[model samples]
Target: MFSDKSCVNATLISGTKETCSFFIFEAAIHWAEEGHRVIYIAPKALQSPPLTHHDRSNPSTEAFKLMRFMYLPNYETLVEQLVDLHSFASLPNVLLVDDLDNYIEDPGVKDKREVHIARLCAILLDTMNACAVILKQNVHICVSISSECEKIYQLYFDKLWKIEEEDDGNIVKVKQVAACNAANKTYEYRKYGSENIILKQILYSQN
Candidate 1:
């Protein structure tokens, strides 16, 4: 998704409370297939059964990496991991964070929800500047957040998208709600075969 820019950030919001793991997995696989290294960070590891799993057991395979948090991670710990992954001087990398709001909080301190959100945002922005922007490395940051968290996270990203399941759970709508580099866009997600999912761009009439 990133061509000219050394670093690009995007956000995805789920239209429903249900998880969007299928979409995330497809995206991760797509990036890895394109020769970019993917680092996936999740609050918990495989709490739900995935629709399909990507094979990454080969020792020589360096396409994907997964990191799960047993407990809430502090800013320092979070930054360190991101910096290390992004430190690959000549390689392209994608940092995929799933439900960041759930894993990035101070466990011991009882803080307001807003405060926790703010702190996470600060850390993410700082990491973007220090690790991605400064290094001039080809990096992509894609985060999946809930609707409530979208407002706070939107300002920090260059592109924002929303995915929702509709038509009694048969049809999926993927819309580009906000973007800095292009006009608004929308797409429909459909199944290609028994298990494959695909995206087709659709034009929406303003009327």
Candidate 2:
């Protein structure tokens, strides 16, 4: 949804919990097919059934292979992965984190929850900076979070986009809520296929 020159230090995608995962996966697939090596990380188990059932274009075997899915059950594990990303044989072009709020709002961290969240945000920023300066790689990082958590996480991201469903779910609206150098814009899409799976961008307007 963003241009190649757009800063990728951090990008937040906020939407309803029901829609975040699907949209994130669609983005992962799209980037992967475009020759971006993608890494999709989530706290919960990602079922293979949904890949087959997804309404949009299904990924081919080779395209799907370009994506590396990691199931990190908790925030600690997620943090460890982010810290160790530089050790990878090859850096991924895109990194997608699903359900980021789940990690930040864990019930076990009843005390100093905000502190924990802030630390995670800092680590994410550090990772991005290290990738660009230390490793000389431009890795795009996107996180899917519930709208409620957008305020808490937005400061760490260079850009923020909010997604909403409209018109009995036939249309999807993507609004650029915040950005560093880009104008605030809104994009509307309509389901174009007989099954209503493919989303075609039909409108773009500056806000």
Clashing pairs in 2: none
Residue 67 Cα positional deviation in candidate 1, in Å, after optimal superposition: 10
- CA lDDT scores, all candidates in order: 0.56, 0.72
Candidate 1 on 49-157: residue-level lDDT in tens? Answer: 3444233333224444432222224545556665564455543356677666555454754767666666666565555545555556646667776545446665566
Weakest ten-residue segment in model 2 by summed lDDT: 48-57
Q: Clashes in model 1: which pairs?
A: none
TM-score against native, each model: 0.68, 0.79
The TM-score of candidate 2 is 0.79
> Mind giving the per-residue lDDT tens digits that candidate 2 earns over 20-93?
77678877888888888888999877664232223556788888888999999887788889999867876776
Task: State candidate 1's TM-score.
Answer: 0.68
Q: Point out where model 1 deviates above 4 Å.
A: 1-6, 16-19, 47-49, 52-92, 104-109, 147-150, 179-182, 191-196, 204-207
Number of the top-ranking candidate, with TM-score as the measure: 2
